[model samples]
Target chain A: MKEIVVISGKGGTGKTSVMGSFSYLGKSDLVIADCDVDAADLHMLLGPDYQRSEDYYSGELAILDQDKCINCGACLSVCQFDGIQSENGTFRIEAMNCEGCGYCQRVCPTNAIQMETQKVGEWYTSSSKVGSTMVHAKLGVGAENSGRLVAQVKNEARRHAKKEGKEIILIDGSPGIGCAVNSALSGADYVVFVTEPSVSGIHDLKRVTELVKGFSIRSGCIINKCDLNSQMLDELITFMADAGIEHIASIPYDETFTAAMLEGKTLVEYDKGPASQVLIKSWEKIKQFAETEGCLK
Target chain B: MKIAIASGKGGTGKTTLATSLSSHLSETQDVVLVDLDVEEPNSRLFIRGDQTHSQSICKQVPEWTGDCSLCGQCQEICNFNAVIKVGTQIMLFPELCHSCRACSELCPESALPLKPRKIGMLNQIQAGNLIFVESRLEIGEQQAVPLISQTKDYIDNHFDESYIIIYDSPPGTSCPVIEASKDADFVILVTEPTPFGLYDLKLAVEVMRKMKKDFGVVVNRDGLGNNDVLDYCDMETIPVLARISNDRRIAELYAAGELIFSTIPEFKEQLLLLERSLELSTVVDPV
Candidate 1:
């Protein structure tokens, strides 16, 4: 199945809104995957009825046995991270500070420390109101290894797509150039970047675009809030042209986008406004691009 | 006093408030504004300053130098599987490595030794009374927490207790945001008035409460969003720091990378009140 992932370098640029509309349009033909495991919001918009869930464990955490403790301060000395704590001659591990390197476990002569895998998060498969299967995950607050959780969600979506013989996978990626975004971009057929015309938006777009170039994946750009600043819009257009990124559609700034979100509906599902029309046009272009053979080659 | 401006949702005016508040406070206090959103550091675009100093930062990761006896102990102890032992060689994956040094230190053959790998850079800029420090992670690097920790360490080493520090933290309630605000004296949570904003703001508030941080809420684009955010804050007993109205001029200035205080009188007045309140909150008792 072909994969179309939507991401915005800067947050609040309507990435989820665009993805929600795309999911509504591609409901019958695609499976939805929300790879923003750190703060997954696609499930909120899709109203997914979760059917299956599995606990996901990625990295290990150190566990100390106080009974076998010989307060030599050996584990604390060998730890690169400040994970070990000592108070009143008792030692404990700080879960937030631990990197799970297993160095402390090795240094303990009393065999008091052992590495145990942690269930950091969970991934789920659900059927949404739009009559499509959605794969998403929830990372525990302040948990590490979000990139792994994203990978797990994407894999599950791809597996379900293969099993159901779906034609496409529409992914909603996280906002940043970090590990989560990187994992979401891997092995994607096409990427759609939703961006705005603000200075921070343009700045972050350039940074994230540089990252996408490394993957050598075909990408299209959708300019949301195109009418906010004419000068910045011109500059954005010039940059996109120079970067050889396809300009999909220019969506005007409209409150209807948020209004639709407030009502727990996609823009296309809520209203047939100008913004919705532009989004529909953008989806058509994306569909044509995804179906085109030799596009990746 | 150290303040962090953060939001769970992106583009919620963290950098906008960080840059403007730092510039205004610099008029009477020594201020250091840090851009801890290393993945996408945009504070540099808004805060123009003279280049004072810059340096490349590196993290220590294990590398094989062909000195192994095929002991395979390095691969066994690595928790992240960043190191792997092949038939006649050991392979290293820098992207997967957390720089935990478990593999290198546990190797009995001494083949796996820690080496410095470039991950990102830190640039310091001086703007009048404010010293702006921005850290940018190199492309393809996965970890942002280590660089953020190092940048905060740099600030702690260079600046004394007198300087008021402001951090423009990353968006999201994950590891990066947690690292950015873990040591702040006060946190300013920025949010919009829409459902998405309120939803993400609730997650951020939960994080702050779990961390036991003293924080207030700042409502950007107040007229654009509904009153749910204010009502939620009232019910939670969270102070409303300031409300920036939804204005085209503000958007225009932000698009042009201009400061809001210099041209917007209403915003300036709101920031002044915020500054006074922050001063009263951060005052230390005399010995």
Candidate 2:
């Protein structure tokens, strides 16, 4: 199966909006996964009916037993992560700050600290309204190991795609060039970047594209709000050309985007506006590119 | 007072609000703006200034010195899978290491030792009284929290509490956002007025409440989407700090990396009101 991940280095560039339209267009042939576990919103548009969910545990947390604890502060001293909190004569472990490195447990003089596996999030397999298997996850608040959860979601999506004989695995990736984005891009066949014609957009695109180039993935760019700044648009076009990235589509700024989002619909499904038409044309190009480029070995 | 401007959703005007607010405050008072979104820091795009300083930031990870006794203790103790023993060779993956020092300390033969690996760069710029500090993660680096934490430490070492510090935090309700906002005196949650906006806003609110942080909301693109976000904030009794109207002119200025409060009179007025509200909030909950 071919995997195509849509990501924007900067947030609010319409990554999900584009993914929603693509999911609708790809239908049963696609196994969709939303790897933006931090603030996943693709499900809001796809209307997935969750079929199964599994608690995902990746890291460990140090739990201090106050009964066995001595006030020596050894665990506090060894912890690189400020996980140990000391007040008066008492010591506590802050779960949020704990890196699950188990250093505190090894350093505890009284053996007061114990390492426990932490359930950082949950992943779900669902059938979306667009008739495709959807795999997504919700990372716990203030939780670490989001990259692992993204990897889990992608693996689940791949398993489903292979079992169901799906041709494509279309993924909606997160907004930053961090661990989660790295996990989502692993083993992907094609990468589609959804960006805007803005200073921040171009700046972030440059950074993320640099990261992607390290993987040598075949990629394309979709410029949303292309009409907002003519000068910025030219800059973006020039950058794409210089970077050897194909400019797949240039969508004008249209209110139909928010309008469709408000109604819980994708831009293409909502109305045939100018932006929708451009995206429809671009979808064809993405399919052709994905097929011609061949799958990653 | 230290204020963090954050949003759960990307492109929700966090940088716009942060840069504009810092620029406005710098007209009279010294302001410190730190962009904690190390993975994709964009505040530098809008808040240009003279380069004052730059430095490469590194995180500590364990490195094998090839003196292993083949005890296999380091691999067993490592929780991040950053270290592994392969056929008489020990491999270390610096990108995956959390630098917790467990593997290094637990190694029986002292084969693993903590070493610094460059993960990002920190730059300081000066625009009049506004000090803009931005950290950008190096390409192929998987983590952002270490850079963010180091940047905060740099800010604490350089800037005193007399200046108003603003953090342009990364989007999401995850560890990076938590690390950025955890030490702030107050947090300003920026959001647009859409279903996705409202959904992510609630997640952000839950995170702030869990952190027990005092926060308010500023709705950007006010008229672009429905009133669900405003209504949710109202129901939650969270203060609506400001409302930046959905204007094409504002979008154009933002697209061109221009500050709205500096050019738009109405936006300037809104920002002044926001400043007043911030003053009232800070006074009531003084640090």
TM-score of chain A of each: 0.97, 0.97
lDDT by residue for model 1 (A44-83), tens: 7899998999998877889999999898889999887789
Q: Can you list each candidate's DockQ?
A: 0.74, 0.85
Angstrom error of the Cα, residue B161, model 1: value is: 0.9
Model 2 steric clash pairs: A11-B10, A11-B11, A12-B10
Model 2 Cα shift for residue A111 (angstroms):
1.9
TM-score of chain A of 1: 0.97
Candidate 2 residue runs with Cα over 4 Å from true position: A294-297, B280-287
Residue A270's lDDT within candidate 2 is: 98
Q: Provide TM-scores for the models.
A: 0.97, 0.97
Number of clashing pairs per prediction, in order: 0, 3
Candidate 2 lDDT, A1-297, residue by residue in tens: 789999999899899999999999888989999999999999999998988999988788898899999889988888888999999989999987888889888888889989999887889999999999999988888888898899889999999999999989999999888999999998988999999999989999998888788787888999998899999999999999998888999888888988999899998999988888888899999988887763322
